[model samples]
Target chain A: MPTKTVAGVTVDVNDEGFFTDPSQWTEEMAPELAREEGIDSLTDPHWTVIRFMRKEQAEKGTGPTVRGLGKTSGVTVKELYQLFPKGPAKIAARVSGIPKPRGCI
Target chain B: MNSQIGEQAATAGQPDPIEKVSVIISQGSLEGVYPGLIMANGARAEGIEANLFFTFFGLDVIHAKRHEHIKVASVGNPGMHMATWLGGVPGMSSVMTHMMQKQIAELDIPSIPEFVEMISDTGAGMYACKASVDLFKMEKSDLIDQVQDIITVGEFYDIAAGGHIIFT
Candidate 1:
């Protein structure tokens, strides 16, 4: 288990940079993680996706698939790419401090 | 450092092509189609262009009337965890197909038709192999509307050029 220092706090992360213990995630770390994912800033729509993903993970024990997120997160898939770039689900999950969404290959 | 600069200069004239993924679906079983569909959709989710080519038994997946009828192949499927002889029993395949469908439904996964529609809606290209179509005597009308066209293997390769090609 590798550890990363985000926001002056050490947290475990997997080889792919996904948080090993999602419970250790903090709101303050979101922006740092977002920047690391290549997004310069988090807009309201971005927060909407992050918050929706966190809520889904808390209830479902895993983040929603990209299709499910697009359908339910009030953000369309096209817009999700605009916000998160190359890999929305993985990037969003990392920024939200959750495991990669199920069925994301 | 000189080598690095040379390498950069060698490639500076042209913009990089958009990342693309080409998936070949060769089997028509429930298990086979889902992986290809999932992968294509995954590529789209990753903002990569994706194309799915159906050939051989995979043509069943694009058949307007048969796409929905794909069944799980339990007979001789080592993953079924049963006696090898039992797998050959009649009706077992259907039972296994139903079981798999139920499991997928429980996971909130869509059916094959619906999954195809969803992937197509994502701008993923769907194609059928011309060789398979000719061998099976299938016409363009036999395929789902989502299919862009029936293309030869050479054309498929040409279109899939400059991208990762995955066979499932």
Candidate 2:
């Protein structure tokens, strides 16, 4: 049994060993970040889009395009600003637990 | 261009001089599963300690339900038709992905689950992207068995920074 703790979230992994909540997710669950940072990371539209990306990634294991994710979630890119003034990559990085992707870093 | 890909141990703090392979598995789909899976597997057969990471769509290769159902492309993908006998049209990536999947499959291949098993059996490193896990709302329960760790892209790079990185 292997276990990792991140941001007060304890992830207990069994012998097969899977991460319950990927440890990198800290101060950035979108929802959690908003509550603590007073920055509303997961706005309605952003939530819609991120949830969609998450679903796609979970089922497919790949990230979705910002435009594609927006289209599916019924939100315009303009609405996304309220959540992540930093743009999609930041939100994607925060949500994906990726700490910003190749270009951003 | 008679260059043959090769590998040799890189001295600490020095880059690997050989053309080593780093495999990123991004699709959890049946069709998208093989490239990363088998390529990592094949690299290992050649004695390379490949780094296999599963991200976004590629994570399906390591998930429970869809691992074995992973399939070869058959549609608008232009994958089914033979541009040449037993291979795809020249210079197209889809063809290569398709052919590689088949070649690996015919070699008494295993499903994505089985492939991961073999990867472990061969001592290759395996990781899953953390951001994708959070985005996908996947509990650790969502991942397949044998994933060594869940890391952010930064963490993955901390490992990948040393070797050749490949995205499939």
The TM-score leader among the candidates is 1
Q: Please, what are the lDDT tens digits per residue for candidate 1 over residues B1-168?
A: 999999889989866755999999999888878999888888887678899999999999989999889998877678889887887788988888999999988887788998887788677899999999999999999999999999999999998998999999
Per-model CA lDDT versus the true structure: 0.88, 0.57
Q: After superposition, how far is residue A82 of candidate 1 from its true place, in Å?
A: 6.4
lDDT of 2 by residue, A1-105 (tens): 576444566555433232333343543444653444245445565566656655665665554443344345566444543354434434554454432222200
| lDDT (Cα) of model 1 | 0.88
Of candidate 2 chain B, the 10-residue stretch with the lowest lDDT total is: B1-10
lDDT of 2 by residue, B1-168 (tens): 223322223344465444456788776555566667667755554445578888887776777775655555443455456444344334444545566667765654554575577566555677888988777777667777677888888887888775688887
Query: Scoring only the second chain, what is candidate 1's TM-score?
Result: 0.89
Lowest lDDT 10-residue stretch of candidate 1 chain B: B9-18
Off by more than 4 A, model 2:
A1-105, B1-20, B82-106
**DockQ per model, Cα:** 0.32, 0.01
State which candidate has the highest lDDT: 1
Cα lDDT for residue A105, candidate 2:
7
Cα shift from native, residue B153, model 2 (Å) = 0.5
